[model samples]
Target: MEYIDLYLIHWPMTVKPGKYEFPFPKDEIEPFDMKSVWEAMEECLRLGLTKAIGVSNFSSKKLHALLSTAQIPPSVNQVEVNPLWQQRKLRELCVAKGIQICAWSPLGARGALWGSDGVMECAVLMEIAEAKGKTLAQICLRWVYEQGDVVLVKSFNEKRMMENLDILGWELSDEDNHKISQIPQCKGYQGLDFVSPSGLTNPSWSFGMVRFDSIIVERERLQRTVGLIEPIVDSAVIPSGIVISSIYLKYKKMGRIPEVLLISAAPDSKPMPMIGFGTATYPFGPSEAARSAVVRAVAAGYRHFDTAAVYGSETSLGEAVADAVESGLVGSRDELFITSKLWCSDAHSDRVIPALRKTLQNLQMEYIDLYLIHWPIIRNFALDREIPPAVNQVEVNPLWQQKKLREFCVEKGIKICAYSPLGAKGTVWGNDRVMECEVLKEIAQAKGKTLAQICLRWVHEQGDCVLVKSYNDQRMKENLEIFDWELSEEDKYKINQIPQQRSVPAEDFISDVGPFKSLMELWDGEI
Candidate 1:
């Protein structure tokens, strides 16, 4: 007990309470509730469970989210920080928040999971190490120490251990630091399997992929753009980038339901609602049904609409917007954000603008707020003039996490508006892999939220705009209700641990008779 000075949650995602397994099986993980869990940590502080409570592998955004509700913010964040994987964002955020930065994989985890060979093999680190008359590992540890970070280094050999402890004796030159910073960042260790959804039920196969800062990066994106959020009635969610706030203002208006949170693309772009209404449905569902749902969505305070030419519901969606304007549900078409996509057949370079124009014509709108290549794979590609797509529509959920694709989109500054976030559990081609997942069900039961709500909220929590579709008016309203509440850090964690599957795979097109060959050829083996 005396030796244990600090206790930490090693990873954010919590596996089932019993025992930990490498290829963690299905129904073995529980959703993580960050605030509630932190509160428990605070209780530990009261009981002297440990002198300090800390977290490992947390990013800036995750730390910020933790800080948002923590009674006692984390004392430290121990993470991988090396010459090869510099974690600059996490470092700066920790400094600003007065939480000490602790580097765990100081030498890039050469023999461990999530470690990259790049750190040991880096030309820049080798150059510095040779010049300084130190081991490359020593130089790596020294570099982290030079950055005012506490480095946790390990060595099993006596001589190597002495050298590991000797990092403080020497310094890395300023020129060397610059070169190290410019090493052309690529992740070394990827443990995305920790949060992947598909491996749970089927234990033999696992989702082995890279997870950079989904918890941190996505949260940082939201915080930088949307700012801090509070659930109290006094607080408003990202409205006009902070115009006014007063707890007493509720008296000025009574019984007012919260509206969709509005965020700007840039400082100049008009504010657009985050939760959008999806016009896509079961292939057999009628356009009129989608049209009616759009009306209900708008009346329920959704101002963003998503559709595609492939979905064949654009005209009805447009008519619904027109009807909403005429009936005073919305002041003008400008108040709503409309997004459409180019189906595969018309996804050709020359056909791109024409397809968008066709969609615009069908919707009776002059310009679309967003347009996307409905599918990223280009069976054929060249170039033609067209507006840049503001978003890319994809099927994202706990089961189909799409970690690599999501990270790439986040890196490229493209918004990922997820459709079918619940995995379309009841659809003909769809299965219960999503809604019936025990982790999701546990989260729903714990939070007192529906399975659909937990899934929708999971998508939103990942810091992407989400589109939800429902035929019934009540369900439409229910789908639109995601904005007012939130999922906890634990909820997000459990969702992350769900095994990944390729939802809505174009198997028909991926067969030997079709384009290229194999689903692996199509997805680059991400599935």
Candidate 2:
């Protein structure tokens, strides 16, 4: 073990150099210098001594300060959380910063010296455990897991460990979640031993425990700001988009448009939405922004969603859907259509099912509405499958309309779902060619529409489904407004005359040793 997987600061306080002991001298206590300490953590990451660095017991204020000066933001924040102490405020802050919460003492450390019996003895948890036929600890742990946070439970006994791991296969009902939400909140652990007399300031808390003074209060006063301590909108209260960047944003109920049957022959096929939201973003990684954006999209009436394993958005998309359901934005998961793709690397026969299963797991869904081979260059896909492919998703925009493939797919009863419909600006495979087209610009100006709206309208008018990606609240709603308007024949003619070019060529998939050897071979001269 040359390198550790994760390294975290145990506490956000410092003491004099000596053999470690509790109840340190007040004169020896010192404020934690976050900037210098985080710099060293960054150095540790750079030197490959640790895969990730983070902090434990960091309140929202401390985490905010560290993030402000951090070259590399904390990957995780280890915090104490349970039904008794949900830490919703702290959890929201961490989510917005893209910091994962690793819940310590998730069961409230019921038997430890610093633990409380509140979580273990709560009547709400007891009732849930009895009704569900599970242990109280299991019920507590499952609730934390459902919050999209990691749970840490220590059990040396074999049977107890097995019980802890068994929380995954099933879920708590919405009623159970509601009951737990009403439980009185109070933190279990109070680090009063570390609060020095000299540094002590505010001492009282809801639980009647002495809160650490300088660690929680002073640091908060110094670090808290309108931007840092500001809370994310509670979907239950707000149930819509919130103000962002000093702009009030409200996601309009774009309403459900007609769904197109993907496979006319398959009796079990679900209809795919004609205009879907794309969750693929450049600098691909899962973040709260992705989840929050998807939630807002759902509020704005987006039913069909496009995600892939490689895009790294499946988890966030899944979480967002769960949130939407919990918030009553949608009746259930079945009401929304979700489509995921098999990555090119997993195109082999042996890998396909496993990849799809992993995709389902990431999405936390039993089945996918539509699944497509992300690209054709991976391995040769046989057409003799038990289920025929329903859709062929590719790059399509005003500049590159993919006329040849579009006609071929429509003739074969397969729908064409267009990705990069606006040239996918700011990505390695994307360029500004489509957005900067003079012809589309003139048409957009004349019609009093944004350049993006013009491109999407053209794609929708072509009888092809469009996948539009946007994180902005106003833009997300604006993308869905293309259904009402109709593009004129002259506007269509001008768009058709634009020079055609593919935005995303499979150069990365091509290699001398791999299946695809060149661009021409990959696309079979389609480009």
Candidate 3:
């Protein structure tokens, strides 16, 4: 009885009719019999192997049959949970039977077997975690515990296991709990659906319907593009001409040193641009074109470089940075700013440091000048391109969530750079809204600036260095011209008035394939 907080019957006796294996046979053993499993569980309890015994992944039919023949009825039932796959019926059945329900996979598991949707990126969870100075995962786990059940979280990593245990002491507000419960449920598992006699079933799981076919098309396009670039370069590289040297020249003419070019605005570093290698470019990774562009940027006298751990091109970028320094293109690392973002998969405090260290090692640098959160939301989904509801919509980190990280970086004097300054072009406020937002347009009109200029200026005005990307030299120059004009108080106010909106809904894309949840989680507190 001492070995287990609860004993578990691992799965139902049979998988979908024709399937011989049970519960992921590639990893778990097959030829399982529920009757024998239940009897063994009973013996374990009688032999003091556990204080309680439970059945895991069991259906109502199986549990009913088991109870009909058992000398000692099961004391608990465990099932997958998280907003997607809420397992409501199983939970209710256990409740009615006085059998405790132990929730498993509270945070959703990695890879695609779990559905992909950004449900976990709930605004409520982010908000609460932000207020409490806790992680969204902690808040989520606590929510599960508050539901009056034993929560089982599995993490082979020592740090994660400890972090899981650390959740016992916190309490969630009723309002927060209510908000969590209200999170729209989305279906994540489709393997079972295929097993049904229906042969074909509509994947109507929530978080909005995903056109997996469309995503596949887009992903294929991206993969093709990546493949085209992969053979030409060894790592992620930024093209030189792509950077706005004209803007640097213009700023010099204005008697402004333009020491930093902030990428975007985030909660902590609000109203200030973040620090970085002057005006950044996007689609960071290995490419001859990108390398040529970076070389040109270096030749043209640009000195800063930015990349992230997950970009898979830091080595190339690092090589460029080092070459620039060695050739006296930049006097020293201090003279050249290098920035990278921590991936969301490494957002946990324990994981954060190691990830950063690995990134640094890969870049062949002692430390980075700036590190940022790629996005503010965490996508809860599997890492597959074919799956629907591809991202688990989870708010792994809320706005104002990087305070600790910010302080840490600042303490180390590492400047923070924020990406997706205007909430991502594809995300909140699409190109149309960005171009037509009454306030922004008015500001642009008043300042005689283009929409992109106004957007970049808004980020620049925030104080930290700002980074804006454009493959076209003219557009890059335009994005950098932001320093030439300042937003008026009214203009600033108007820009601020635009309601918060995310253009990239997690459901539309696959999750867990990249690091960090929405771009926000990657930023260390510097925002």
Candidate 4:
């Protein structure tokens, strides 16, 4: 009982109906009785024989049948999963059912048993591994590790074992993640013995068929159980994956909003955690006050930190991240997703890389998780760079949602993170039109939520990410409560009925003598 905490139903097989396999006469083959077996497992849980029970090699079709009848729902499904396999069908089913997924041989075996090493030999995985200064093994492990699933790497050699353990302390970038997805999927381990015609398998669905119900369920079971993002590793507990919005967050328990609320550059790009820490404050530089606020956010489970060099919080954010890791609030620099923007002054192609380098130096990190163009000014027309921008941070709210620009960017496979999501209430540049709207106020009262949450949730529910700033801890926590619940159809219809207008009439860009003589010309009439 003490040695093993989790006992699994390895495969969907049991003793032949009239023949007992456990006390085998070394003659009879095992027959399938998955239902009765699972019931027995539940009884074990009731008797305290095991803390949890799950299954392995059971496809999504099998899982659904089990869930419908299970008295104690299985907590996890262990399987031989890898980048080569992709496991999209199983992953989707697992995400919806709140069952955690853990991988057995995450890296495909070739020399060990299988003739071909799909994962370790793949060009994309190799390329990513080289660029990230990690082993192919590490890349494969990290890929699944990032999937918010526990990866089991089998190696007795000290160096390779060390490499497996080194999965922590660093991470794979979205670029690497995209490349891995580009590799065509082929399962490395087809070691299922029960798939043959004579072997026992589910009668309702073919052994290979993996279909499930359309109903999707999402629960952050992995974060609460494994705590994989924390520094103190649990010896007995393994990591797991939860389906949130059909995207894998790679140990995204650090993601404050659970159930996979993320924004991606591409459908395949490593999805960016939804909420971001906005540093566009009254006094831009990372003062002690600004740094303290970020630190508090870090402690409160924020991984995406948004700052612009112009905001003057880069250095303070850098310092704060270093402090956060040293203080054990965060596990590593990679755990927090740092986003920095290029100010308009450095918008020229020649100045872009140097400006980004300067920002990286200020943040005191080897690489920034995401670097963006701060503005869409005329200078952007002439800008150039080797690395493309990941996101375009702009002012957007219900009043100025910029639906057209967002669609264009989505086609280009670039994400849009809305700043000033809430009407920047305290600033001269912002107005109270959104927060003070009568419709929004009525919706807030009806939902029993704050006006700020209503506004932030609107942007989140629109399938976009939002940046919000709150120095107040209580307020910051409130802003992040978007994913737990959702807006109703009536509330959404009321919001859509809201009148739209451009908040920032860029008069500064218009001059009688300049090219943009009117605000319409300045924004091409978007204003």
* Model 4 vs. true fold: TM: 0.53
From the highest lDDT down, the ranking of the candidates is 2, 4, 1, 3
Q: Which of candidates 2 and 3 reaches a greater TM-score?
A: 2
> In lDDT terms, how accurate is model 3?
0.50
lDDT per residue for candidate 1 within 1-527, as digits (tens), equals 54357878786666767776665763465455667778888888888768898898776556777888888988889887777567665676788888888887777787675564657876668878888888998888878888899988777789998988887766788777766754534344444345323222232111111111111112111211221211123433232253222211101111112112122233223333456777766674337777877887776666678778877788898899888766545435766778777788986789988888899999999887766666554211111213334455677888987677666655444456677788777776567788778998898888787888888877766666677777777776666556446676777777777778866776765767765497666666666
Clashing pairs in 2: none
Kindly list the per-residue Cα lDDT of model 2 for residues 111-221, writing each as its tens digit. Answer: 887786768887779999999999999999999999999999899999999999999999999889967764535556755445443333223211111122112223222
Q: Using lDDT as the measure, name the better of candidate 2 and candidate 3.
A: 2
What's the C-alpha lDDT at position 141 in model 4? 86
Q: Tell me the TM-score of model 1.
A: 0.48
Query: After best superposition, candidate 1 residue 163: deviation in angstroms?
Result: 41
Residue 180 in model 1: lDDT: 71
lDDT of each: 0.64, 0.73, 0.50, 0.66
Superposition error at 321 for model 2 (Å): 0.6
Candidate 2, residue 457: Cα displacement in angstroms equals 0.4
List ranges where model 3 is wrong by over 4 Å: 1-284, 298-303, 344-354, 371-417, 426-432, 436-438, 504-527
Q: Which consecutive 10 residues in model 3 have the weakest lDDT in total?
A: 243-252
Alpha-carbon runs more than 4 Å astray in model 1 = 1-272, 284-286, 378-389, 511-515
